[model samples]
Target: MQTSLNHYSQNNEIHKDIPGRKEIIGYGLGDFGYVLIWTLVASFLTYFYTDVAGIAAGAVGTLMLFVRLWDGVSDIGMGILVDRTNSKHGKARPYLIWMPIPLAITTVFLFTVPDVGMTGKITYAAITYSLFILLYTAVSIPFKTLLGMMTQEQHTRSMIGIVGAFFIQSSALLVNMITEPMASGIGGQLGWVMTGTLFGVLAVVTLYITFRTTKERVGFVPTAKQEEKVKLSSGVKALFKNKYWMIITLFCISYYTLLGFVGAELYFAKYILGNASYFSIISLVKAVPGILAIFFMAPIVKKIGKRNMVLIGILSIILSTFIKYLDPTSLNYFLIGSAFNGFGKGIFGAMLYALINDTVEYGEWKSKVRTGGLVNSAASFGMKVGTGLGTAIVGWLLAFGGYVGNLSQQSDTALQMILYLNIHIPFLIAIIMFLLMWLYKLDKIYPQIVEELQRRKNE
Candidate 1:
């Protein structure tokens, strides 16, 4: 690994060279759009479904759990599909054009309050969500894998990621800030329907921009088979073999699972703060630091390299939880700590993909196949896993607290329990994630892997 930096530094050409600057910003913003829509749903959707839309709590949890499991399994196959695609635009970009319409439609559907029986609601959520995330994987895997093919260096890729994270968080921030005001201003079912439709459109447009701006850099190697190559056995084997990849995926799984609970701040603000309007402020406050995080990302990754940045991010979040848990009953401290958690999350958020670029290089050297989309497929599943589990757990907990979603109607006992779980449980999970990361070992070998691969290519 020692000589690898010099290898790339000294030589100018390589597979999946860094993406152009315009492409970087475009992808970041585009991904942010998709993430924004989904994060809103993830953050507030359960509350929306249970409290607002009237889906039962356990049913909502169960539906999310099932759909995410399906999404996880499908991710492996989608990765294979990306590897096999032979488009003029490249492996991943066609999905960019084809996916947005479906992506947009499905996202809107997830938010729709259909007229149905209790069983019907659960079925609607499970089926629509399953379809939505499946399409999401088809789009996102390519999007994420492009990061690897976009650049070879840790710093440059991290720069792209930094920009991407900003867009994602910003999109969510925008939604968080606006959803209530927009809904309340308009009033009733029409208000919610209007808000969702607007965001849904924005989501598609942003993703379209992301697709238009970026070019697939590492595609065009001839292959014996694209579809056949991406089998479940092969994809799973490939992921597990890369010890570093497994570690990265695990950390990501845990990181986002804990972080997904961040979505519940709406519940906290509305139910606990006793003012649904404050949800808007929560969005504004948390997002300000995320924007600032973009400026600091490159330098942070540059100084510590990528893996340590992940470690640092983990530790930072863990410590922030101390403030949250210690406060226990204090809303001020919990909200304040959440902002810092957002900051820590923003830093490592995009940097992790920089590490992924290195793994893509390593995988190419070992397996002699480029599965950028497949790599992202795994990541998409991990995201879904975190998100799915976050919703499942939160909904279940909300049920425990007797949160009926209608703040106007919920019992005082239920309100207090809702507040307790919203603040404390996620905090405990954040602390566990910190300890979990201490076990990773991928950061020590970037230059080593590069040197070995280069020597073989030369020989």
Candidate 2:
């Protein structure tokens, strides 16, 4: 009778369907807002600073590095806040409702460079950018934390993550394809201001819909004996002690660092390809493969497991990037390589959050405390560090290689550096990611962890 009861309890835990299509779609829409802001910063912010704001490349690099370090530090405080939050909408979801307007406003300010002297422009950039990152951290940390709160079923979490990836990539694609033309067509600084405003409004609407439609089903409700709040240090310690969390955190750092290669595409198109608008075609090619890859992601993950699938995807990116590096001058080769890279990116991007969500469970099962916010925040910290480093590398290298903004043609040296930044750096990062995935053994142990947690819950 006890055995039957245990089996029934396990089945009940596994089969809970509180998050259906409405919640999944709502969750996915949040990424639409996220990627709109993120892609704008990642793909165009440096360009705006250099060409429009007239900041030097070296200064831009130094500023990004400094700001992102501060940004990463701030994530810990945000994580603590999320963990301690008690609200009608739950810990993470309320941020979705309350913070989007601030986020949108800050995003607009980030793109709005004032018509001031160079020092004034730099100061303006720093202040607005810092505010934007802080607001983004408040909203994004919660949105990511929401995934773990919504469901314990790995499959359901994976589905939500995959759908989120689809939306994120789609939003990124639209931003990439249109941003240059939109900015140029509108003409000058005013054009960028308009573009930021347009997306800012969209961000507000989508985030509100996400807040309205999604429900948090699996928040940490402490037992009477465990009611005291967990210290931030304890949460951080628990996160590092979970081997899988460490692996995923390492992978995210490497993955997002590789993604920072997008920052160089505008330079590559303008200087190397000899057409500023070629970036649109490159983005379109890259995005389509990733978008199409989503259709196959779930079945592939189920068949091969997330680790193997991720490994396969990383391998594809490494190989494709190497090919692009070998013939950097050939547009056909670059496009082909980008297509493969996009496929790999699609697979990895879709599965990444699901993998992180698993680590939340692993930490909980081992530590006997749920540190979902801390775990996700730590992951965000790593990503912010990687992004900062990547952007800094590009900026510093451009300065070193003598890149000048608004020049019709670049020196051969600067063009070569753009090629290296656009291709080889990403390849190296992917190799590191591949090594990190090899160290991950969570896929083998996750079922045991889940079953054990379920058993403990029932007892």
Q: Best by TM-score, which number?
A: 2
Compared with the true structure, all predictions reach lDDT values of 0.70, 0.84
Q: Which stretches of candidate 2 lie over 4 Å from their true place?
A: 1-10
Q: What would the per-residue lDDT of candidate 1 be over residues 1-459, giving only the tens digit for each residue? A: 112222234353453455666777788877677776676666677777877678887778778778888989888777777777787777777777888778777877877768798778777878888888888777777777777655555556667777777787788788888887887798865777777788778878887887788876554554344334556566566766666566667666776677667656667777667677877776776677767867665665677776676667666676666777776457677667767777777776667676666676666556755456666777667767877787777777777767675757677767766665565666676666666566655556666666665565555
Deviation in Å, model 2, residue 277 alpha carbon: 0.3
In angstroms, the error of model 1 at 215 is 2.0
TM-scores of the models, in the order given: 0.90, 0.96
Cα deviation at 415, candidate 1, in Å, is: 3.7
Worst 10 residues of 1 by lDDT: 1-10
